[model samples]
Target chain A: MSAADLSRCSLNSATVKHASLTELVDAAAAAGLGAVGLWRHQVQEAGAEQAARAVAGAGLRVSSLCRGGFLTAADEAGIAAALEDNRRAIVEAATVGTRELIFVVGGLPAVSAPGQGPRPDAGPGDRDLVAARARVADRIADLVPFAAEHGVRIVLEALHPMFAADRAVISTLGQALDLAEPFPAETVGVVVDTYHVWWDPQLREQIARAGREGRLASYQICDWILPLAAEPLNSRGHVGDGYVDFAAISAWVSGAGYTGDVETEIFNEEIWADEPVATARTVGERYARYVRPYL
Target chain B: MSAADLSRCSLNSATVKHASLTELVDAAAAAGLGAVGLWRHQVQEAGAEQAARAVAGAGLRVSSLCRGGFLTAADEAGIAAALEDNRRAIVEAATVGTRELIFVVGGLPAVSAPGQGPRPDAGPGDRDLVAARARVADRIADLVPFAAEHGVRIVLEALHPMFAADRAVISTLGQALDLAEPFPAETVGVVVDTYHVWWDPQLREQIARAGREGRLASYQICDWILPLAAEPLNSRGHVGDGYVDFAAISAWVSGAGYTGDVETEIFNEEIWADEPVATARTVGERYARYVRPYL
Candidate 1:
């Protein structure tokens, strides 16, 4: 596994979130990586136009934009606001020169305002997950023309079920593909992130279906760490540190004919503490050894 | 929502883990509850035969046995040991006189023995979840004959996906039902515990399927609490306390024609801190308010 084998490797800016967009782009290019996946906040910090110019100047491809969806609001005002925000995200993705804009599709609406703690009046009867998910589907359909017009694809990422309530109601690749089915494959696709979907029983079949339908938008890699952190969001491990079968899953993705950027997107606090350049080098090496062979 | 409507309520002993088998039986009976679910250790402390006698003497039914399967071992000896333990559990379930013996089928075998922190040499490539799941299927087939002879149904309970690596690989009702399909539904079944499975997107369809197949062995109820505990196992909330929609899910189960015991099987430190009798009464009231109408 040499630097030459890392030609398809992409550094997701969130993996080294401490780094500025400029620093991530520079580190990724210096490490001989072919692409970089940018987060919305990081791109905004560098200014989307400047971020695009920097990546292009560094001779690196913009693999994808971090995210753009939170359409599960209980009220009309909230729904309208979410759609407006997503339309802006589509424009941002277009500005950053990436066709793939991942959408996490938010979870159930909050019963009360933030920091109110658990609602004392709340009961088991208040949540309607099915309705929340339906709203996500409808909102995605609404955003399809906007995204397509901007030449950006809406990549629906299925978060692990642990985040089903507060992060993403779409918890499996099959479900994401199901939601994406009504739209054009190029305009709406699904993300095959190993961190979220590795435990899925229907992973192989779903990946195959996504490939068959030309809906395999982006292939992201990360590990599932044990003793999950207090903030479960930061529990993702470096590629070789946890229990995901990356080689097998990567082979499935590669076999499905996905020839796109392979992003190493981790969210561990420990990994975030490392120097950006060193983290990029380490991730690149791991990707070469663990994932490149399969590809 | 009167005591008459509570005729199907059962106190799962784990919901009050501090209580002895005798105390559980007596409290459940005194509360006018119809049944009590027993755990093996609690029954052993009271002596299984004596425990059976006491429950009968108290005129209470044994709703189900707490557990019986951990067949995800990699080595032959480990696999044999697990099967042997499950055999004993089958006998214990029969002794306690309950047809439903719920199995929280264990997760992937540890790379090394206990107390060795995450295996340094282990990687995602080392764990074979597909093979581990296949072993669970094979072991369940091996135990079906014994369970049949004892007239005890082997109930496979899908633990939450967060427990996929260390607790139970059977992480969805659909997967559990798929595993149980090769065997007789009467000899092998699936436990639909709300805490473990409420996040599943295909939950309603799977519950309906479980009913149509007559394999809905146990209907356990508990809430999915927020800010999950440091140890996820203790995160189960009392019925009205968390985000689970009991009325909706229970309606689905009831609509499927399930008339079994509704076991309130919670595992929270806060709930366990209460007096056993008080806890039983509170749970009964909550069940009457939140779940009884649907049933």
Candidate 2:
């Protein structure tokens, strides 16, 4: 398939996670995918300006920045540090020419995050999920002006409920939209990642609500595989390889008036081991067959 | 602790899975638990009448039957078989002297159910989750009369969303309440298992709503432990061992007017390997410390 076959598809960096900044851009371009979702780590490694030039140089669009939220800090110092880092993330998003800056948003208070180790100093593990959710809303509010100034929207991504403890307190699209409703849609928006939200009972209603609110910033797709991995986070599959109903979800998004580029964001270990260009091409084929028709 | 110390506590059989029905009844009796939640398997193995007699002989009340709903089957045979099995489960619940019968509704279409192997003839994996959910509603409607006739309330248990693909399609209290609302509260009700729903943002309101509708049938507790086990089904912990805020959840349940036996139903491998009596007493101590005060 050529670029013409996958016009509306974007390859999320995590799909071919082994690929470096230069490698990913090249793979996306060679695979005939027109866009790439850049993670903050890769962007930082290449420096934002260089990364932007390289992406543009390859004739590809930057769909959105990977993440910048872990705002569930319990202590004052931790909270301040999280906000400061998010501010920097906004600047990087602006530099890279993508208005959307996805936020994985941290876990419940005092829990050990994946990349960040234990926060024993933060006091006993806080199971105040409501408080943590409120903290996310407040942090988004704090970053809204900065995000707006940088022309980057603080895109709220609700990780699946399974990750509510160690990855993100935001566990539903409805909750993310609630947090975004308080701000201008342009300044604060929510993502509709099928893998994280496909099982939600209120998904259709919430997707419609997100569209009506003018806060549907991005669309991410991946399949929910069976027999979860040893690490649940690595259990995602390619678009058609597992159990997600992409056609149904794509219709909902399209019905909601979201015409943005769809990003394929699989996190499977085996998929990552594939050649980056091959993975991108495979994502494009699956997206075309499973999602494009419905969209 | 004595029976007086945990007046409202019940030990679910799964908490001491290694014990036979006789041993479990005796262990729960010795541990001072005044009630027990019976799983259909053990009850089936011993004959429901004998199981009830044994529990009653130990001076233990049968709080509720473990489960009975896999109504999401796609094929006619699968659907009929599931309904027939659930009907038997209702009879078993009645024989065991419990008004409540919990349902862990089946997962997506065409997938191999945990105990049952693959369904190659069931056709390709059906991703019509909305359709699968609708099937559940229709099946529940079909079973309501039978459940009510036997003085059994068909209790909907919303398993954690992570289990949505393989275990239960019902994933939230609100969703469960919606399904239960079409029938009489005495005939159809919803369960609030804290392990399954503690992370829900709308949990407090939903619990209050479940109570308001007079459809809150059962209250089960266990902690949502960190580092989910390889088999996530066994990921639960004792009340005080994880990040769940039992005080907060218990207060909600109390405020919701659920004055019933609070069953401790942990499925941890380690806890199962412990001495049945020791595990029962440990569950009692944790429940008394973390959950009872607020209730």
Top candidate, metric DockQ: 2
Q: How much native contact recovery, as a fraction, does model 2 achieve? A: 0.44
- Where model 2 places Cα greater than 4 Å from the true spot, the runs are A115-125, B115-125
Report the alpha-carbon TM-score of model 1 versus the true structure: 0.97
- Model 2 is docked with a DockQ of 0.51
> Which tens-of-lDDT digit does each residue in A1-295 have in candidate 2?
5567687789999998999988898888887887999999999999999999999999999999988999998789999999999999999999999999999998876576552333546433477777888888888888998888889999999889888878998989998998888899999999999889999999999999999999999999998877788888998888776667788889999999998889999888999989998998888889888888898
Error of model 1, residue A125, in angstroms: 6.8
Candidate with top lDDT is 2
For all predicted structures, in order, the TM-scores are 0.97, 0.97
- What is each candidate's DockQ, to 2 decimals? 0.50, 0.51
| lDDT string, candidate 1, A1-295, tens digits | 5667788999999999888877898899878898999988877878899999999999999999989988888678998999999998999999999999999998767545322224776444347788888989999989999998999999999999888777788999999999999999999999999899988888999999999999998999998778878777888888877777878899999989999999999998898999999988988988987899888
Candidate 2, lDDT over the whole model: 0.88
